[model samples]
Target: MRSAAADRGAVHRPPCRADAGPDDLETDVEEIQNSVYWHDTEPVEVGEPLDGDASCDICIVGGGYTGLWAAHFLAEAEPSARIRVLESHTVGSGASTANGGFVGLTAGKVLRRLLWYYGREKAAGVYRTGARSIIDIGRFCRRYDIDADFAMNGMLQVVTDRKQLARLELQVKRSERTGLRGSFKLMGRDEAQERIGSPQVLGALRTTGALVNPHRLVQGLARVVRGQGVDIHEHTPAVDVRRVGNGYRVSTPTGTVTANEVVLATNAWQHSFGQTHTKVMPVWNYLMVTEPLTDAQLDRVNWPGREGVSNSLSFAHAARLTSDNRVVWSGGRWYYFDGRDTGRGHIRNAAAFRDLRESFARFFPAWDDVRFSHAFGGPIGWSRTFIPQFGRLADGVVYGHGYTGNGLAPSHTGGKILRDLVLRRETEYTELAFVTVNQPTFAKGAIGDTGAHLFVWRQETGDRLPLMLPHQAALAPRAFFAGRAARKARAADTGR
Candidate 1:
């Protein structure tokens, strides 16, 4: 088997940074294409679109991880059942190929919210499930001979300032109380810096997370699914879905699929349907990849474990090394258009790319000369509760989505949940906290747009507040998040 990192070679280097203006930064990326680095790693054979009417036992709408995983599991469970996956573009062309490829465990704000809503046992169940998903993905890759650069090297949730440090301390205490003491190891400033050579890292919480080449993972999974007799159609967008007798009819641009069961696995695009319009909010995230680092450049960072690193802020930044040694830097501010627009037009935002470049320079000043080779953006589904939700929408229609930003590993759990729901089984997956009947939805129209803007402002502002200020200066935003969690928990309990 070929190693995922051994194939790629370096490109031309750009001018080094020296307090350069925005124009100079623009020059650095001027020649770079707005494309995902993962997609360019290898060539993919695109499948044919649906040409006419079709029928299947199970129809999955979305060829990303969720849908592909669901098909894989369903095929394993019921070999006689016919499964089909519909994709708007190519498989894994959206967030799956564009995200920072950290197969993460639930942590930071997401874990906090899970603990608040569900008690310790339930929250721990979710964590355990997430952890198992990571292992399961590795096993699946090995079983299918998919060389996705699967490395279970773990991840570090670092604090850049004193305020974040305080918050990380509290989070550690909470995790300890929740019986997850062994899941994370707290590291002081020096120890944290040893793992990751960054002066900004005040403290770190190390968790058992893994990383993978997401494009290879998804594409390999699609091939496995197709080999298992599942039909996958690329460039076949589901235009509409409606109830037809005992089944559901999914209309696509060129054909229609009538199936006994339907799975709405279109992560960010789930908002396009009425049943999920308010249930999911589509937010755009941007990422940039640098040219492959030289041995000396890698030695400067001294990231021997090559663990994925992300900060502990509401609008956090995450960095990880690709299989080919390029640094993938992502996350600063999430963008939401005035309307819920998930079009190609929003994929390349100049402002977001500039912010990403500047933030990367700040975090790893040792790599001041490293130039970015690729920049791209994609939409991710953000639930109001900040966790993924999957259950039946109607009798024959089951959906799984709202992964927020971390879906690679959990989507494995989601596939099992979806499989059980479609089979009407009362298994452990069906009892998971996020698998529910009536999940909460965000506000609609102008209210939702305004609220999303305000939420982003609060998160970014909280992260940007000076450490010299009093601790109380950051209390307002913290309180806001806490209050919202409480309200969401209450609403979920009351089925509102």
Candidate 2:
């Protein structure tokens, strides 16, 4: 599963001077490879593209984690059913391989909003389901012998400033009050420093989480799906999807796939389809991976557990160590292009790379001498509610998108929900909090683009000037109610 192409022909350069300011490091982006580090770790053997029209019992678009997981689950549940997955690019080349690989609760970040809108019981149910999904993914990897470097190391939600500490403490309290007493452990400055060794971290909330080589996990899952008699056609994009005689016909560049049931598993690209165009906004996020740390450099930090760490800001920064010991840092301000553009032309944002490098150095001064070997960006499908949505478009079509940049574990949960929907079964997955007939959507056209920019500005401003502004929690109610109003408006128009 290794190839010479994995090298990417990247030329390493000398590390930026430790004394160099953030502005000085911005010009050093050329030293990094404009590629995904995870993808370069292994070779992906793409399946042949479809040369002719095809028909199957189930047709799945987008061969990322969600689509592959759905195929794997459906094949096991209905061994004789025909399943086909259509991928626009090579499998797992989308956000699945572009993320920081911090597998944690999907709704954990929005727990307060969930409690405000969906009651404590339902919020807890979503949180519990997320916790179980993490374990289930580990089991799935072992069951299929997929060596994805899965580790159940907990995650740290550390606060970098005093203003953020109170919000972190509130989250811990809410978790306990929601019947998850032992799920989150609040750590003071000393305890938090022991795990992260960052002077800026005043406190943290350590919670159940895991890490994985997302590329390996997704590629191995695709292999398992293929072994189970599921057809995966790579480099085959779904051009359009239309209804046809109680089924759906998905048009592709190579051919067409008419199936009795269709699963729209394309996350960020879901906006390209009319059925889901307004349902999600594709926002670009960037990441930079440092060259492997030397033993001496590793000793400079006290992170023996190698836990994934993230800050408490609205546009937070997250850092995690890869299996090979490289630090992958991500998260800053997210960008939304006009006209909902998600093309590859936007993958190399100089500003985002600069922000990531600066933040990484600030978080771990010990790594200031380490140079980045890779830098890249990808779009994440964001729903207005900051959670995933699962439901049927028509009797013959179903979709599971809107993970809101936290899809690794929840996509597994989404697979089960899609499975039950495709099989027409009333199971627990279909009854979860995110599974609804209608979810909130973003505004369309120029207004939508303006709103997206305004949201990003607010997040960045809050993180930049925490003391000068109110806590993000204070603004949560207004955002939540705005989403509620949008949902009601959508429901009214659709008469659902």
Candidate 3:
């Protein structure tokens, strides 16, 4: 087995304050600087890279959730078949563990957007698939005894500014109309504060989004799959994959893997594959975690449930409590790596870190005395549509990637979809919207890059613009209300 630490290179710390003494808040910030909270908790153990020539019944690339889950299911379905997973870095190195640990559905408005693309039945089916994925993941954790700190403590999508109130309210209405499980409910200001105690919160939409120690979850999944007779190789990057006769030949620096079937489970790095290059964008997102709050400090927040919390901004701000009582903050700002460069060096964004710090202070003024312990970033595969792209790229070549940032639950469901595709079996999983639908590929070259930049720019600018123009403060809410009313009127008129 290879040491996972070798791939991590050097540790990058946050900006230090020269004026501060050893006894001040600067120490807290430096404590967890430039490392993932989950990975820092435990040492990751991974196997050696693929050496020489190898052959398998199924070859899966990338050791993150997508590849691990696919291998787990495939090994179960065909016990006699040979299974191998090749990862470029250590297991859980990508978005799998480097995320905000949000186990949520890609439903909400994305469900409604599906209605526009597909019909009502298909849209509802798509929404239900994602909703059920949340349940399926929790059940798997319990059944396998993977103690990843699985918490079904629910999540709160709060609106900090008045401009966001209508949007939050509309989501509640949409969830009700879409017949989502009885989990999503509109909360008044007082109720929202009781749940999260953030002064910026005006209202919230509460739903059963689980929180987990993502690092533990992925590590556990890898362990379980390996126990079931799956071979996993770390520090092995699949440099080239080409069709050879009835199977595909995957070349790596250390060796070559020829398999009857190949599944590309690489997420953000999917762009490196010619078949998926234009189909996904490898963009980076940032996160920061605070030092463990004191018992007295925890009381000031009043969140006994310790639910996951995120605001309703387009470039939304999200925060969740860890088992150790530290708050992990992410979003509010994201960046695009011009040429799909997901090198480890690109993971540190000083600007994104500063923005996250300022936003955290604004949202939780009561925590002024508190300082962050860690700050880090990771790449997320963004499809043209903010949903995942799933299907068979060619015979025996199935691919799953691009969950935007909501990969935890979706990846579990996607894994099953890949299994069905690999086995050439038609089941409910094969008919789901994400698997059956054709996702539009992003424009290649400068056009696609420019569009991606502008999309991110619009969200960042929109969130900050209101502060500059007090006169336009009420416009967003009014516009949202007007749109909601129009949708309601159309539904009533149709009487369907």
Candidate 4:
């Protein structure tokens, strides 16, 4: 078995970068870490990891949704399986706790392109799974009686410019062809304003997405998983993982656990480990919440609806109201995403704190001067492909990461699928286009970062172009072509 000390040396060599900043991790847990939707829930208490050599049929390296779900499933799959979870920190401390509490079945770049390049049947399967994922999540929450403010008022893919209208229309057409089960519509600026309470909208595609209490969900899952008799340990970092005999041995600071199967759900932190760090470049994002606006304020704008809205910009803008009368809206990323929170509470920039306020007024003029109660910012993890990943490594070891900043419902879905993959169980959802199990690998150097940043930046910028350029539609395939050449040449240059 790999010793804990040896594993630590293999991965992160301290001082572990004193530069690890709050931009990478949000600051002050006293502030609003998650939105007001989860304001009422209690926090989960910390637990200890195994202190002696132990054995389990399955051992999960993360305590987030993925690990919790794995434990939940293992209890059923092999009731006798000695299942244990070793978290680097408290359960849900990673992206599971840090995510902006937005959960929908929206798939990203590859999925969208697959529809355009591969046609409907394949794409339909992907879309159908996404639609069903929403149902699956709801079922889990209901079955477990998880109170994460799991609301299904739906999501609005709103647009702010006429040029983007064509792109949105194309997506609408693709949605129709896929025969995905959900109601979707094209709302013009005026119609959208009526529903969104934002006049800045030029168009919108409103569908059944959801607004959630992310931390609450995380805590709830952790609770129920423990209740199911899963052995969970917090503040227990998996210092090393190596194949041992037919299974794996996970070494922590205080002890070790040998298991038949191991799962890693550490997200961007996985990069600290030799392989995943380079493949999954860490990115940062910022979010702000307003003090509860009065019911009188909400009624004037006609935005009392429980729905949530996201714009078509490259960097998305999402807004939803809290039961407490606050509206949490967000947009933009950090300038240098070395996983730092360089831009927090610099109210002077206004981009982070004020942009959403502007959006609220443009969409719903009734919410003026409703001051921001709090602002919290943190790093969000993404993979090179911009698709969330799921796979096994070194025989019985498996892990999932790269939610690309969208990890609400997907977390639940990923956990269920991941557990099934670990146990080799037959699940009806297994037929979905799950993320490929390519082992942890990195893109070539600054070339990789440059290419990634460019595409992300380009998409981020172009998404807003439709708002500014009324006559020309934004194109993704063209962006792909441009990025493909640069990425390949750069990859070769760096030997990636």
Candidate 5:
């Protein structure tokens, strides 16, 4: 099992704290509706709810990858278990579908951090669980006859700067110390250039990973669970859940569901629940797909092959070639920490876009001038600790969230883990690191926005300090977080 932590590191080192580009544009809902990810083509289309109150053995919320996969695993574990899924929107509508289809396996420095915080045994356990989850995803696709273009192509961690090169050097050594799958193999600048077919590439640290069309994959999983006789209700949002004896009573707008257990798969939408917890909001992650390159331009990138790759530069980016011959890429920087929209949650501002255009032209001069076919942007969630926060929110209520920017395939793994938790299965998934409790203080919309803006600004745009410089940088915010959590704890004790 690979570590699921690759994309789940802390709010990225080069945090997002720049001024908002002066513009306000409505997101293209039509683009979202007409996406290749979700088209109405399922064998048993349960687009509507059961029409009234219903009872199931388990009720799952949110139809994104997490909820759907949870339903699949539950049916697999118990063929006769009565499972019902409730989704707020159409399937694959959220981050599950729109993310850059990179199933990141080489959990960058996540393993390194785990070894530092917890002992080797505990950290290794989580890594094993996470790695196996990736393997499980591939296996499940084949088992369920999913054709979301599952590619076993690994990822290349591009190294651009000498400082970044040194970071990779330390990362490689750290991985070895923490028992990485293979030796940290470093490719030279020329070697990286030749291997990735990009002349601008200096060096690379490649690792075993995968690239899957995330939306297609989740849609396929949704189909498989229906084949198993589980009931799924799309456009159904589970708004509230209260413990009823040994089970729960979940409420929706027009109906309610009584279940012995409930799984909360709504990562970004969890705050809608009237619970006092640290929540992740919509942080628009802007993405764009270039038109398929011409033969002459293709030769410049020579992408050798279509594989997922992200570099270590500040506000670095990740890219992959789609089956349609389009290049899909994502920018690596966030704007706020308190979960507010920063310039509509953009990856590239005008200045940044100009530089990005230059970089593209620099790497693949042919692509430099190619116009984008479509641009998509939305939010991805993250917890304070960076890794996913998954566990029982209460008795008979288990949920997971906070993948940050790099969820892709790892969220699938979390799906499996949450399934095991629901079924009480004692597999290797048990030993993995889980953060069930990170009590957070309450902040109104105004205060939350203000604090988040100020903190992120100081961490990112402020030249006085760096966001991630060992212990020196985190001292202030960590203390702030502790204070917030303590305040939350006190409030919970009194109010609840």
Candidate 6:
């Protein structure tokens, strides 16, 4: 499922560095803190941890969006089915609450790859399904009165260099050739700045998507599930899961649960299962939020449409305006611990946040004076093929994960797929390409670590390669310096 075209690299111009004083780049705002900003305004009541032994018709291992959505749809379809969700932490404590909250398509070269693999029609069908998921999520929020601060403001994939324009053009042509004409439109410098006033943005591709308060969305789903008689237990990690005489037994520290069916919705933590070790790798990403902007300050930018903006580079920088007018900025630096470890210690990377803060300054020079109110992050599941994995495992153990960094909308679609699988029904969702694909896994031990490192290096290098060889020749020295910085950053990531 690897993309030779994508691997060959896209030519993009080198990004221009913004001129700023040392003070401007590194603010004296002592209030810079660490917390999930989305949860600060919307606090959710945490459910009690799993108690002593229990049994149900179905037991879900994770209480995040994937599990909650599965519970929601399955409960709606089968009212009498007993469902229980077990969480190691709170419902929204994982990537559900900590992500950038962009409910966009997972068509990051997916359409192109699918076209090469399955041709235009099947690729179009899968791409359309992914797009529909975003719209359906908005409808779900409205019908249930779940105020997740969801806004259908679309998204912008902007490019700062001329080399990057070629990449955007390729994407646009692929979209048009695959019957997604109006869905993706290329915007020049002037048109892009009109949507978001940023000096670094030279061009952009506009696409439909929604921004959400991920914390509120997940909490609202949990409440709805609980109201529908679904038992959800927090702090109840599944220590072991094995097949019983006719069903499965899930053992926890406090007790055990026996169920006719089991679901492993744990994303990054799927390492608990030996089968998922190479199927997914947990990568840490950081995010930061600025204090609320004054009305006068907000007037400086012409982002009245409030579109979620991200650069076209790999491991791109992303930004969106919150309900309170604060800026949620993320990306630029990502970390992968040895042996694919995932825990609380991996959440705080001061160097990563520092790099993000500097990027924020470069993107929005006018906001240099604004101080960040919160900075926090968590791990996301990354598969070798860069596509999410969804299918049934042995012993009636169903699962959906490996969303890489894009899971918000896809999780909803995944819920539908899991529901069909649970009922043993052959529906449209169950027939999608994502459900029937054979995804490869990474190697074990040092080879695996080196492979992951090389992947990151390729993405960074491919992103920096200028389309014209002359430009690449001119920036050869700069590339050497960039490589050194990347090595130093990786060495500093002790995952302590």
Best by TM-score: 2
lDDT of 4 by residue, 1-496 (tens): 2212234453412111112233522222223223322333354567876787888888888888767876887687767777899888788766676555777766434556656655667566655666676777777789989877777788888776555555575576567667752456555556667787676776667786777777777788788888877889888888888888887888888889998888887776776565455656666665666555665666766454667878765577778875555677666644334332223232223344444444545555555545554455555667655556776654556777777778776666677778778877667445444553233455655766676577667766766552443323344433432443465478568985
Off by over 4 Å in 3: 1-32, 107-109, 464-496
The lDDT per prediction is 0.84, 0.84, 0.80, 0.63, 0.63, 0.79
User: Model 5, which residues run further than 4 Å from truth?
Assistant: 1-46, 181-184, 279-282, 336-363, 435-447, 454-496
lDDT of 6: 0.79
Compute the lDDT for candidate 4: 0.63
Candidate 5 lowest-lDDT run of ten? 12-21
Q: What would the TM-scores of all predictions be?
A: 0.90, 0.91, 0.88, 0.79, 0.78, 0.88
- Local error of candidate 5 at residue 392 (angstroms): 1.1
Model 2: per-residue lDDT, tens digit, 248-367? 899998999999999999999998898898889999999888777788888998898899999888788898998878888898889989999999977788889887877877888877
What's the CA error at residue 240 for candidate 6, in Å?
1.1
Q: Is candidate 4 or candidate 5 better by TM-score?
A: 4
What's the lDDT for residue 60 in model 4?
Answer: 84
Model 1 clash pairs are: none
| Alpha-carbon lDDT of model 3 | 0.80
Q: Each candidate: how many clashes?
A: 0, 0, 2, 13, 9, 3
**Residue range with the least summed lDDT across 10 consecutive positions in model 2:** 472-481
Model 5 CA lDDT for position 456: 47
Ranking by lDDT: 1, 2, 3, 6, 4, 5
The TM-score, computed over Cα atoms with residue i paired to residue i, of candidate 5 is 0.78
Candidate 5 lDDT over 291-313, as tens digits, reads: 55567656766567566878765
lDDT of 1 by residue, 1-496 (tens): 1222235544534522424468776675556567677877777899999999999999999999999999999999999999999999999998888798999986578778777777777777888899999999999999999999999999999888768866776687678767887687767667788999987877688898999999999999999999999999999999899999988899998999999999999989898887778888899999888777778888888588899999988788999998778888899899998788898877778789889888887888888777676778989899888889998875557998988999998899999999999999999899887785347889889999998889888888878886654443134534533543465478568985
Q: Report the error of model 3 at residue 480, Å.
A: 13
Off by over 4 Å in 6: 1-31, 468-496
Winner of 1 and 4 under TM-score: 1
Alpha-carbon shift of residue 61 in model 4 (angstroms): 1.1
